[model samples]
Target: MTTGFETDRISRRKAIWREIPAGIWALGFVSLLMDVSSEMIHALLPVYMVTVLGTSALTVGMIEGVAEATASITKMFSGALSDWLGKRKLLAALGYGLAAFTKPIFPLAPSVGWLIAARFIDRIGKGIRGAPRDALVADISPAHLRGASFGLRQSLDTIGAFFGPLLAIALMWLTANQFSAVFWIAVIPGFLSFVLILVAVREPKRPEGLRRIRMPFSRSELGRLGAAYWWVVAVAAVFTLARFSEAFLVLRAQSIGLPLMLVPAVLVIMNIAYAISAYPVGVLSDRIDRVTVLIVGLFLLLAADLLLAFAPGAIGLVLGVVLWGLHMGFTQGLLATLIADAAPAELRGTAFGMFNLVTGLALLIASVTAGALWDATGPQGTFLAGAVFTLLTLIGLLPVQTRLGKREAS
Candidate 1:
């Protein structure tokens, strides 16, 4: 039933997906499905809230603010609990399972308050699961290959991003903007991800000689390990301030006379760019320092923000979107790897959780701030703000880049 092209396509996928340990590849598959489920609801949430639920922009901002902040706070706790308990996979599974359980509620929600409730539950699940899952990926892979492994996960996740929107668009077309209908269908992929995560992944042993007794300030993650990580977090928050939501991009594209129907195509293009760059960039991070690779990614993002700020038309938007995708490839796994290197294995879950918590919180703030800035000035001002954040991030990371380089040399 398959042609040569189909066979080749299948073979290439098998190899790329295996860049992580086989179990992580499996996790990637789970993420792919979960992302599909998520985007199905999330990509349209703002629009749905505005049009169907009659919510205001500030309400949407508040929902995202509350949800993301909740995720961040929970991530730290979950990660720490995983560290204390010395279990990664079980917590990770529970996290995904909780998110899975919450998916259906969104479609059935009668009011914006209900939607916010469902979103909070889902993001709480996200906060809990993300750190452990990332720690598992780090636990299994060799240090040299960490970047590539996480990259593979990112690549797979991006594939989900591409599919979720297309499916949502088709569902939107068929249902005639029945957003609730799309939400119901999204439940399928969410549960599928939960199931696959349970069935497919296995936890490896804790890293060797991990001290069981909690450390004092000198030995605590909050001390030596915490400083650089916190710096990275602060700088990343700055970058987040610059970036804001991609919805702004979609709105911009549409405002400039790109057909409303074709905006999803632009999203598809960016996801493709992300999928293409993730694996190689990840592999590159393994060979070099994660910071070096991260720098490259951030620079790419800086360029992307600048492009979007002054984008002239469809072509400019396409270019800017692609760059943004490339930036994703750079940062996604790179964040995981950085924590792995800085924190001991026992503390990995906490490290990743903290990283995400900080960045996610930053996003919540940035998105709300961006909206206000847009209301006050314009979209161009919004993106120009992002450019400034990226510049500051680069400066903050310079010392870490030097340290990471030294680690690579050793």
Candidate 2:
């Protein structure tokens, strides 16, 4: 039933898959395992905090914001260290190890303070690994396959994201809705992730004639990142303002009369859409203008926000979640790819660090604002605010579209 054109297309896709480095695949798997471990706890944490601990939505938002901000700040330093030491894998392994060890604390925490501390420490580990791991992927992948590589890694990570929730849902059913028991089981995968990264990932050798940089964050070194890179960061920070944390998604689902045991299904559904769309979108961006693709992603987010704000019933909620995931798939890897394309190889770690720093801070502001809105005006206001921000981001992208296109052509 396959035509010649279809056969050629299939062969091309196979060739692209084969062209990705083994190390990238290893890194992807590493991400997959860690996300699996993290999401299992996170999918349940918001509801647990609200219901079991008697925390307010505002408190949950504050905790999530602070946790993420801490991670972002840590990334800046850890990323610089990775650049100075020229050993991404060592820092990466150390990060994952720290996270893995911290997993038990989630189940053991007796109070909100202890839970906050655990989440804080866990995010620090995430921060430590994030930039270096991304830089490692950029280093390993050929320039031509950069989009595909990041997409593949993101798809793999999201697969774990969905799987984690599914496992949590299943465990909740089996354990009679015992949250602590599910958290305990989540510890196993975290350790597995740490071990896999330590053993499986092979760092590429540094290129000849590549000078070792002593100060990745020095003024002169930062100047080397250029206007193009900063523009990408600025746009990304603004875009992040529209997205907020996924915790809100869980809250929204619960608000609609979804049972406690099925709450994790919200993440399960969104991540499934995210996992499915990421790779194909990445490939499409590789062949077209990345900025155009990003603009489309913005539109998707806008649509999601509108639907989440005004859509009726369970079907509407599910549709909005899918759109949210699709937007993530279209944009997340592309942003990383943009950073890799813009920054000098020597400064990649620093570039990613700085980029995340700005966006993470933006997310903090957005989450806090969203929580306040949710408390004062309900979920409708929170999501409508998101839609407004999404529109602003779309407008902001106008000036930079030509520049991004020229960069892609170059």
TM-scores of the models, in the order given: 0.88, 0.91
Clashes in predicted model 2: 0
Q: What is the C-alpha lDDT profile of model 2 across 372-394, one tens digit per residue?
A: 99999988999999999989888
lDDT over C-alpha atoms for residue 111 of model 2: 88
Top candidate (TM-score): 2
Q: List where candidate 1 sits over 4 angstroms from the true fold.
A: 1-19, 46-57, 110-113, 175-180, 213-219, 224-226, 406-410
Error of 1 at 197 (Å): 1.4
Worst 10 residues of 1 by lDDT: 212-221
RMSD of 1: 4.3
* Candidate models: Cα lDDT each: 0.82, 0.89
